[model samples]
Target: MTGLAAASLAVSIAVAGAGVPAQAAETRRAPATATAQVFAVDWVSLGIAVAGYLFSGGGGGGGLQAAIAEIKAAIEQSKTEIIAQIDAIAAAEVEACLEAHTIEFLNIDFMDEYTLRAWAQNATSCATQASAFAGAVQSPQAVDKIGFVIGPIFAIVLAARAQAGFINGTDLVLQSQIRAYEAVVTKLTPTDCQLIVTSEGSAFYEKWWRCTAYNGDVGRSSPCFGRNCLPNRAMAETQATLNTSRPVANGALPRLRAALP
Candidate 1:
C-alpha cells in the first residue's frame, strides 16, 4: 500500500482504535491483522512500522484459544504504548520548530525608534530575516525539524498552502514596498519634516502619523496636514508595506499550526 494509505490505516488503528474495548472478544484479532498487513505490505516504507509480530497466536489445543487471546491483549497494549511514544516525540519536534521561529515573527524592532530612518533600516532587516525563515520552512530539510512522521502526515491531512510559500510571497511584496519607502524617506525635504513634527504633539503624532505613514493607509486623513498635504507616493508606499506586513505577521503562527497535525 502507498505511504498515505498506510498512514491512514495506521492512524485509524493507532489513534482511534488504540484503546481496545473492554468487551472486545474478536476485536483484537481484527486490529492485529490490520497491523500485520501494514508491515507485510511494506511496513518500513512509512518509517512508522513496528519491528515485528510480538505474538504468533499459535500453539497446541487444550486452552490454546484462551492463551492466544491473552497474548493478543498484551501485544495490543505494547503497540499502543509505542504509538504514544512516537506521538510525544513528534509533538516535541514540532513545538521546538515553532518556538525557534516565534520571536522572529513577532519582532517589531522597526517601530522601536521614532525616526523614519530607523524604521526604514529595521524594516529592511526584518524583511531579510522573514525571507530567510520562509525559505527554512519550505526547504527539503524541513522534514528534519517537523519530524518524518509528522511532515508527511500533515501534508496529507492539512491541505493549507505551505507556510513558506505565503511568507516568501509576502516578503517579495514587502521588499518592493520597502524600496519605495526608502526612496520617500531619503527625499523628504527639511520643510516637510518640520511641518510634520510641529503639526502635532509627539505622542499623538507618533500614534497617528506613524500608523498612516508606515502602514501606507492613505485613505485616512493625515493627522498633521490631512490627506491632501502629505506626499502622495510616500503614503502609498507605507500603506503598501503595512498592508502586506501586518497580516503576514499576524497570521504566521496560526497558519503554522493549521498546517501541522
Candidate 2:
C-alpha cells in the first residue's frame, strides 16, 4: 500500500478503537445515551468503510492502473483512426489531381487552342481544390506525413495552371496574327477591278492569278511561318510545362500510393 493509504488505514483503526470505548462509557453514563452509543458505532463503521476503500484501489492502486491503461488504449485507437482517415483523404485528392489535370496536361502539345483552353479551365478548377486542400491540411497546425504527400500534388497543379496560361497567351497571338493577315490582304487586293466576261474565261483566270500571287507573298512573310510561328511556340510551351510537371507528378505517385490502403 502507498504511504497515504497506510496512514489512512492506521487512522481508521485508531478511530474504531477509540469509538468502541467511548460507546461503552456513553452507555454506562445514561440510558438516554443509547443514541450516543449508536452514533459512536456509526462513526466506527464509517471509519472501517473509509479504510476498506483505501485498501482497495481508491488510493491509486491496481484499479487506477487498469483505468489508466484503458484510457491510454482508447486514445491510441482514436489517433490511429484519425490518421487513417486523413491518409485516405490525401490519397483521393492526389489521384483526382493526377487524373483530371496532370495526365491531361501531358497531352497539351496535341490539343488545339480551343481544346487547350478548355483543359486549362478544368486544370484551374483542379488547382483551386488542391490549394484549398493544402491549406486545410497545413493551417491551425500541419498534419504529420501529409506535407510529403500533398506538396508534389500541389506543384503539379500549379504547373498545369502555368500551362493553361501559355494556352491563353498563344491563342491571343494566333488571333492577332490572323487579324493582321486579313487587314494586309484587304489593303493589297484591287478594290475596283471588274471581271470581264471573255472567251475561255481569260479575265476570270487573270484576276484569280493576281490574287493568288499576292496571297502567296503575304503567306511567306506572315507570322504563321518560320521560328516566330505561334503554333511552334505553343508546342514549345506545352513541352516545357510537361517537363516541369513530370517530376512533381512522378514523385507524388509513390507517396500517394503509400498513403492509400
Which structure among the candidates has the greatest TM-score? Answer: 2
Candidate 2 lDDT by residue in tens digits, 69-168: 3322322323333233234444486435534453454465578878876776665555445434444442211221232223322333323333334323
* Model 1: ten consecutive residues of lowest lDDT: 46-55
- Give the per-residue lDDT of model 1 (tens digit) for 1-261: 122222322322322232333122112222233232221211111111110110111122323222223323333333333233234332354443333222222222233334433433333343343333333442322222222122122121111111111112322333332332222233221112212334354333321332232222332214444434443433333332232212122222232322222
lDDT of each: 0.27, 0.31
lDDT of 2 at 40: 20
Q: Tell me how far the alpha carbon of residue 193 in candidate 1 is from the true structure, in angstroms, after superposition.
A: 11
Candidate 1 segments exceeding 4 Å error: 1-195, 199-207, 211-246, 254-261
RMSD of each: 25.5, 40.3
Q: What TM-scores do the predictions have?
A: 0.17, 0.25
